[model samples]
Target: MPGRLKLYHNPQSRAVTAHWMLEEAGADYDLVPVEFREDGTRDPKILAVNPMGKVPTLVLEDGTVVTEVPAILAWVADAYPEKNLAPAPGSPERGSYYRWLFFVGSCFEPALIERMMRQDAEPLPKMMVGWSSYDDVIDTVEGALKGREFLVGDHCTAADVYMGAGLWWGGMFKGPRILESEIIQGYIARLAERPAFQRAMGG
Candidate 1:
């Protein structure tokens, strides 16, 4: 087993998703809170590990640093196979798991940012952007959860943790159509009921 991990986090940021994943995996970890500064300078400790100075930066026992939410979630899930937070390697469900995991960072987040942050700006050409359009991204996610309890197999996995966290965060911020959709809201509610999720939220 790997030694205890260290996660640089800020509760108000996307690091919460990584925190949720750590809880789900039942991994032994320490939360190193990274407070934001008015002048926009990052903690030197964070910069010493990650030049980007992003939260959710995970330092492994071997001193390796893992940045990005999805990568951290994937690593923790794999590191604790006994937790069953991931599908069996090379299984068909694993493909779907990876699909949704990447979907959040690649599509959902970008689309959400555009819809929430770039409302007044001219809509970028769909062909020129990786996320295409906000509507399409939301539709795709809704379709994925239409009749399924989880993103991959029958039970919760790292995919659900990642996707669920994204949807929950989106709804919390009143992202367009996210809270309005019954399917999305139901999924968020279901995920919120998970003990790990609740703990991550400090409940």
Candidate 2:
């Protein structure tokens, strides 16, 4: 087993997703809070390990630094297999698991940012962008959740932690068509009911 992990987190940031994953995996870890400066600079301690100065930066016992949210969730799930947070290695379910995890960063995030942050700007050509458009992204997610209780297989996986967090955060900010979609709202409610999610939320 690996030694205790270190997670630099900030409640106001996406680090909350990693924190939730840690609780779900029941991993032995330390939460090192990184507070930002008024001028938007980060502490040297965080910059030393991850010059990107991003929260949710995880350092393993061997000092391997894992940045990015999906990578962290994937690592923790595989590290603690007994938790059943992931599917069997070669199963189709595992393939679906990886898909949704990657989808969040690849499709959902950029599309969301373009939609929310660039409302006054011209819509980027669908053929020119990776996510195509925010409407397409939302439609894809809604289609995925049509008859599914979770993103992959019957039980919740690390993908749920990432996806659910994104949706929940989006809805909180009133992301277009997110809160209005019954399917998305239902999925968020289910994930919010999880004990791990609740604990991460400081409930």
Candidate 3:
């Protein structure tokens, strides 16, 4: 049996990704909603659980706290193997799982943030920049998503939950560059159909 799990979340935030993961993993958990002040400060009660004051923080029965969206999603997958939301440890597919999961946080996120903020005017050397270029990151993801349903294997895993949420948000709010990409739009549409995704969105 799994430990008692509680998820601190804000519906408008990235916590939705973890919510989808929990639903996908079939994990019974409680959702603690956190509200942000107009000044952008989080509730102090939540800050006690996550100093960063971020949503998507997971607290186990032993009070082991887990932060970060990707990390939380990864843990849920492994914690509920019966859901088949990830490849087994030490398998080749697991390598793909780890690669894309980390890439979303390390590479894709920075790239998207840079593009959305229009901070690309100052070009840094490839070595100095972790994400390199926005276009490069987009191309890499497009290549991986092409002719495929999920990031790791034929089945949708936690990686898709993370990456799909980012893609869907980007296309919805980022700009025409993302919205114009048929592959991405189509992929997001497919992800939106999943019951887990719908439930997380409060549908």
Q: Residues 21-84, candidate 1: write the lDDT tens digits.
A: 9998888899998888889898887898899988989999999999999999999999999999
Better of 1 and 3 by TM-score: 1
Off by over 4 Å in 1: none
Instruction: Write the residue-wise lDDT of candidate 2 on 88-157 in tens digits.
Output: 9999999999999999999998998888899999999999998898999999999999999999988889
Candidate that beats the other on lDDT, 2 or 3, i.e. the better one? 2
Estimate every model's Cα lDDT from 0 to 1: 0.90, 0.92, 0.86
**Ten-residue stretch with the least lDDT total in model 1:** 194-203
* TM-score list, all predictions: 0.97, 0.97, 0.94
- Clash count, predicted structure 3: 0
Q: Which structure among the candidates has the greatest lDDT?
A: 2
- The TM-score, computed over Cα atoms with residue i paired to residue i, of candidate 3 is 0.94
Worst ten in a row by lDDT for model 3: 118-127
Write model 3 residue lDDT over 1-203, tens digit each, in one string: 77679999888888989999999988889999899789987798799998899898999888999999999998889899889999999999999999999998998887787777866476556677898888888898989999988888888998899899988777766643678888887888888899999999764
Enumerate residue pairs that collide in model 1. Answer: none
User: Compared to the true structure, candidate 2 yields what TM-score?
Assistant: 0.97
Candidate 3 ranges with C-alpha deviation above 4 Å: none
